[model samples]
Target: MENNLLNLRMTSKMLSRQAKRCQKEENKELEKLKKAISAGGTEEARIYASNAIRKKSERLNITKMASRVDAVASRVQTALTMQQVVRSMGITVVSMEKAAQSMNLEQISAVMDKFEQQFEDLDVQTGYMEGAIGGTTALDMPQDEVDMLIQRTADQDGLELNAELANIQAPQYLPDEAS
Candidate 1:
């Protein structure tokens, strides 16, 4: 996935350069055609300038189309990649292809952004709750209250959790045997 993103980044950079070059050439041609039309008189330069303008416009349109295509493709690819990542990790995420077909790119992008933010929030909340649960600070709660909270947490889905802790033992750190 990272490789795909890197490839996309490189391709976009190349495409941007190409598009810029095309635009510059078109602008230069248009300027020359304008000067020719102004200085050489309409009867002599009209057809030449008209043809030049049409060709330049076509070139510019093609450049813009290419840019739009590249951008859409990149976004769709990223969304598909995100879906794959979720599936591989046994996590359920919104489908990118479906979103691409149904929603505008901006909407899909917004949803993806929100999804990422939510995940970050969940991570921070999980860490804080875990710390509170396992911390040395004693809670004034009754045993039943702690038990209910533990059970509630255990019931949640898609949390990448293992067996519930019966006791908060000090976590072990193993030295790398390969070292």
Candidate 2:
């Protein structure tokens, strides 16, 4: 489980780096677009616009891939946890069966008498252990975070296009004032 999660994480990191490169290239293209627009070079602006759009698309795709990988890693963790629970339950059932077969009324009574205190002590001990060793690994990139990542990419896709285009209005019949 850990190995699978680690591999997915590494893949995600690589995708992230690729996405960052895409973003840098997109930013460069956008900057060039601004220069082209300023210089009244419509052809250059068109090329830069295409390149920027392409790069942004790549970044969005890479982000989505990373998010999916993270989701898989989370699910893998969940499955492993569920497996442990099932194993524990099986062991508990077996123990109960053995206890039922061997224990007399007096033995049962005595265990019942101590069960509450023992359970409480176990809880306290487990709590301290958890506090000492617990980590985000057990709850990494939950569904909500994956959803947020997807939502952000969706919002960013629209916002990037809208905001950049909005800022670049056509010359409003005035000469140099448009710049």
Top model by lDDT, which number? 2
Cα lDDT of model 2 by residue, 64-109, tens digit: 7777776676666666655665665566566556667897776556
**How high a TM-score does candidate 1 get?**
0.36
lDDT, each prediction: 0.57, 0.69
Tens digit per residue, CA lDDT, model 1, 21-114: 7667666666776777779666546665566576667666655555554554455554554565456334324444556778788767866776
Off by over 4 Å in 1: 1-7, 41-44, 80-179
- Clash number for each model: 0, 0
- Model 2 residue runs over 4 Å out of place are 104-179
Candidate 1 yields a Cα-based lDDT of 0.57
Q: What's the TM-score of every candidate structure?
A: 0.36, 0.58
Which residue pairs collide in model 2, if any? none
- Candidate 1 positional error at 26, Å: 2.6
